[model samples]
Target: LVALPHANAQTDPLPSWNEGAAKKSITDFVARVTTQGGTDFVPVPERIATFDNDGTLWTEQPFYFQLAFAFDRVKATAPRHPEWKTTQPFKALLDNDMKGLAAAGEKGLLQIVAVTHAGMTTEEFARTVLDWTSTARHPRFHRPYTELVYQPMLELLTYLRANGFKTFVVSGGGVEFMRPWMEKVYGIPPEQVVGSSGVVKFQIGASGKPELMKLPKIEFVDDGSGKPVGINRFIGRRPIFAFGNSDGDLQMLQWTAAGEGARFAGLVHHTDAEREYAYDRSSKFGKLDKAWDEAVKRGWLVVDMKQDWKTVFPFEK
Candidate 1:
């Protein structure tokens, strides 16, 4: 490893990361995982790090990526289910019904994604994500979904690479869905991203087009305790460092913490509602209950959005 920052002085890494507590956390964790005598230290190349994307890296105020998938899904499916126009949750999402969306609850949102994502090919699903993000913007932020990512977290990703850690996004999000834009938004290349994925097969249509289809079946979901499962599947090693926000990430943090020797786990508590959506322990989306308790008990770092971060988003207010 070279002495130069942002790279091992050997493998050049994300250079755009800024200096901050977030950055420190990242560096300190990487040091623990890679140093020779470090308790959490493993080797250089084997230093695998995992992160949950939605609430952990960005905002999930509205919901997860699948929720956004559902929104577009409902619109596409509405033509078939005409009655959805008058239905409760469908009706809300259809007519730009923010109020109805609020009323739909978790079950309503899942209903929307199930119908939209299950049967499509992986390629078609990717296309849908690209197309939807092109037009969709956050309602309150009024910014493109890609633009809603947290700047500090982005910087943290870069900073980790400066050390010896190989950062991987082990998110609950649809793998194909996030692959397209995450590179541009987070500076994390597509290959480094590990998220939930439906089965995909390469197929050439009779029309002579390359189409990757999303199977009507779910192959895997990279959420909850599944985070560690995904890490094992994709990166093939237990990570030394893990970052997450909600209870859904409990298993991920637990798995990371349970590792032998030096281990670091951090949670980004959404405490700044004025700047971003702030709800924990009781929020409908991205709730932080069990993880919050565990974070305290285990002496894991719990970041209060209002206290730790000097800034949130990239854009200046």
Candidate 2:
């Protein structure tokens, strides 16, 4: 078995994290919440911790991994739809015209996602995502996407769980897309993940087997304002702890902070271009402008990746 990174001899719960204010805050918060008879002591079931996936748990630089998956899907399915060869966005994609694809805008992206992600059974879609994730590698790292997960965040998740905190991934990524691999990668189960989703219908297939067919229409987005709504609708509890890395996750942090008692809201600020990436405010993807300001204003923890992390990825030696 591959030895997963863990705390050093059980002495430190977050060994991958460096000795800093960010690390100290986490440990202090955990201690306060878990200390029996303490004023800040929280019940086990009340320790809900929600984390954003893309830039928080893993890297989402250049672009989101899910969008990359969509692009690959476009290529794989292009052969079946001959008309895609001449279509605007499809033609742009076929020609590897990044500018042209960008010109197509959000409308074009939604069209691509609708075609690629829908019109298949949930089981079929799950298999497709699993197969792609198994072989697909990040462009810069040349490592499997799953291997790109942040080691410090993994340690943080484990640390929180060890302290009776129930961790959940509340991301803007598709729920079905994340469900198939979350347990293996993040140790979070399918039901614990809340994300954007498209419409799906339950019906009998040709073999008389019941199946959930994915539809092109979007059901609910789990970003920005939709985040709190999704949490309320699905998770049924206000998260006491929340971690994210972008403006898109602002509402989640806000919602978590609004909850009563011992709330911890943290943001992972990417500041290590040498080791990984250095981006914020201006980044088109995972932009951290408003949220950064809010974090400062609210006295929320803003973890500087370069300073707070002793290691970046688990594969690092």
Candidate 3:
């Protein structure tokens, strides 16, 4: 048997990150929190880092992955329910009409989610998510969606964990949807994830077995102001560091930065159109409008994707 190689001593913790102010700020903040007897030093147990999953941790371009999954489910379930052929949103989804889908709006999306995500037990949903995540690929990248996660962000998560900081994903995506694969992908376990979710009921099924059935009704919408509400409700502690990429995350950033002691907030600006899709202020999905102003005004680290990252995904590295 051959001996395994050890980690390179000269390897940078954030190898995908280029030498820049944004990278420096992250390293500096981590240093401050871990340094003993320093004014900015924080206890290991108190070092909670929350990250918005969509654009902040991975890609949310074109559409949210959950939406994509819902669309695929609509197609798969169409054979069972022929009435979907005549339905408004379902017809739009079947016809591949983006405009019609948009016109259907939140109501249409909720319908899709209800039909696709509900009725099944949480375990069933977990299995479905696991199978899909293993097979599903990003339309643009032509790689498994899990493989599309940003390398720099992955490095940051690893770096934080190494420094005894606990990392948690606070996304607007479905909590159950994220929980299945987050531990494998982000090194953050299921208990540490907080996200929007539908209601669940514990009941005996027709098979005479007890199960937690997912319901269509919304239990919570964890975005904007709701982010802080979720953080307080779930984590029970204000995060020392918050990372996000949209106006939806402004309140979370504000909440984290407003806390006493040295706080760090970062925004991942999608500026590299060549390596990744870029749209800000006017884009429908993951709009970075009001938050950009706040980042500048508050002197928060705004990471320029083009300038700050040497590589985008792990494949590039």
Candidate 4:
């Protein structure tokens, strides 16, 4: 067992994380796994760590950030389609009626996504998302949505990488949506991002330029069981460490913990409402109920947002 870092250690890698069981657990796990002759020793080549994006890395309360992007796309493109002004979901969306949009539900949300997220070539869609993320601000925080990422988690990412861990983002958000800025924001590159995707096609444009066209149909949903399938398809290796915030990530965590050798699984519990938002079982976005119980039952580390994190967002520091 490697010695734990002192509370006032000058080289503390996770200063934003409170000195507690959660932080100690993470440090100890890394220390043990990295020790050359230790029973838990893991080779650098096998140091795979996967993280869920939304609430695990950043804020996902009120609604999902991608849904917000879809809504914004609808408004931006509404001028081209006059019918959307009178359509059920579009009208509700354009009207800025939260209740009306909620009532529209999954089908309605899908209609909005199909219109806004598809039809364009992958390059075109990438530019569109880039533009939107650059200017979009969170509704309540009023800061750019990118700035809403949890500070402690950012440090954790760096700390893991410093210890020779290869980090990968496995999110439920659109792969294209995240690929554009993930490297810039999270230190994880595009090739390492695995997420929900839509059908795309290879085609030659009118100008004879080869391109991939985005289709409006769903190809994969990288949530719940889909996460593991994506891991298998894209990563080709089992992750030894997994971090997530909701039940959707339960299967991923289970898969990680079940791996051979010393495995670690962690959950981020959103228990702070003042600094961030407080939510659990009943939350519409990033529901954390079943997974919370599962974490306890499985002896996984659960980081309480309010208690375990000394600072929530980067801006708070």
Evaluated with lDDT, which candidate comes out highest?
2
lDDT of 3 at 86: 93
Better of 2 and 3 by lDDT: 2
The residue pairs in collision within model 3 are: none
Question: Model 3 reaches what TM-score against the true structure?
Answer: 0.96
Which is the winner by TM-score between candidate 1 and candidate 3? 3
Worst 10 residues of 3 by lDDT: 2-11
Q: Provide the lDDT at 109 for model 1.
A: 67
All candidates in order of TM-score, best leading: 2, 4, 3, 1
Q: Which stretches of candidate 4 lie over 4 Å from their true place?
A: 1-10
For model 4, the run of ten residues with the poorest summed lDDT: 1-10
Q: What C-alpha root-mean-square deviation, in Å, does candidate 2 show against the real structure?
A: 3.3
**Which portions of model 1 miss their true places by more than 4 Å?**
1-26, 34-41, 76-89, 96-107, 118-120, 201-204, 208-210
Output the TM-score of candidate 4: 0.96
Task: Find the number of clashing residue pairs for candidate 1.
Answer: 11
